[model samples]
Target: MRTLALRGGARVAVVEAEWTDAFGVVTRGRVQLELRDGEPGPVLERDAGFWLRGTGVRALRNPGRRTARVRIVTPRTRTVTCPLPNTWRNEMSSMNDSGVVARTSHTSRLRGLAGIGFIAALAAMVATTLAAALARAVGVDFEIPDGGETIPLPGFAVVTGFFSVVGIVIAAALLRWSARPAERFVWTAVSLTAISLVPPLLSGAATATITALLGLHLVPAAVMIPTLARSLRTRTD
Candidate 1:
């Protein structure tokens, strides 16, 4: 039995000497199998077991931005090590030194996402405020019967900005913890946006006010969802 470590984006070719009669299990992160034609194959997640013998697998790849490990079990009593070329070893060594390279790369991605989120939030605020003003001009009274008070124009900007920040926080959390962050954020944001429409429908406001409120709610969602999702995809890919 032996363990093989693959750094992010690393690939190891399969040699008969090492892989013959070997069964591999993913112990951490993910491992992607490369087919004999150089096409991508199924990705094995943590705890998944696979056999390479008699399969047209060309190589193993770590498709994620984290280290992945695989445990190899063979019938031989001796332990075997996966041999990497000198250049690859040097690169891995540099990446392992204090983990500076990986940390800096991850931190920079987060910072970039935060910057994009802030800009999108500011734009959503301005856009929502303008839309509210236009709706008011068109005789859509921003009044709610429950409160018997008119919602001011500035209220639109403040609310939009606040919720936009919340969206950013959710996106950042997903980016840090989720494997498919962009896809998950899109689904989550869309579900929340759909839920947000309910309050306006039940606000007991006039028809024009309800319609305007629904449109206003969607305005920020349109601005923030795609912006944050795209930023996340860029970083993850």
Candidate 2:
């Protein structure tokens, strides 16, 4: 058990104990908790609760008028694994399988990869919409040089194709070369989402640009996370 003292103007990053499951209670000071990004962390705050377990509450800081104190605890287990049923049987069958079965399974993986490509393409489309909304707000009258009139879907497709491939290249590098596919995918998604926001800032548009920009952020996050997570899944298992 460890005790923390938060002075009149002190802050601390909530930490875990030797055995993490021990839990915590805010005995004195106010503790504000939320997920933190690389910058400008979560806009909201949650109170202390049993969520100290698996919840990745990035930072906990003192937010009280007077001094406060907090108690900390640790979890009992370091790691846990869940085993699947009938997996050994499938492995045995694969050992006795021929080229035809092997080739088919490999093709299935590629098909899933293609679906991800389409999703990335869709992200590009939403990004373009956000770009337009932002451009209008800035009063710069921004548009593709030869955009002609109404926004073209093919143009979005072409742009989506390019960026989607770029995102794929990034995710593939981690999935193939890195040991932690899920971790790498999450970080990459965050970076890409932030990078996607830069264009709106550069746009001349102003009003509601933030709202439009946030909407656009969800588009790619929705597209990338699910597709990337699915790619890591094993259907044959």
Task: Candidate 1: count the clashes.
Answer: 0
Q: Where does candidate 1 stray beyond 4 Å?
A: 1-104
- Alpha-carbon shift of residue 146 in model 1 (angstroms): 1.0
Misplaced by over 4 Å in model 2 are 1-111, 119-155, 209-214, 233-237
| Each candidate's clash count | 0, 14
* Winning candidate number (lDDT): 1
Model 2 local distance difference test score: 0.49
Candidate 2, 1-237: lDDT as tens digits: 555666644555546443144444455634445344523222111122222434455555554345556554334434424221254235324542111111123345446665675676676667666665565566533342343343343554455556667766666655443434446666777787788877756654443544554555566566666777567433211
Instruction: Estimate the TM-score of every prediction.
Output: 0.62, 0.39
Tens-place lDDT per residue, model 1, 1-237, is 888999988999988567766667677877777888998766666655666766768899987778889887777746446543454345434542122111113456678999999999999999999999999998988899986999999999999999898999999887776656788999999999999999999989999999999999999999999999999877655
In candidate 2, residue 40 scores what lDDT? Answer: 21
Write down the lDDT of every candidate, Cα atoms only: 0.80, 0.49
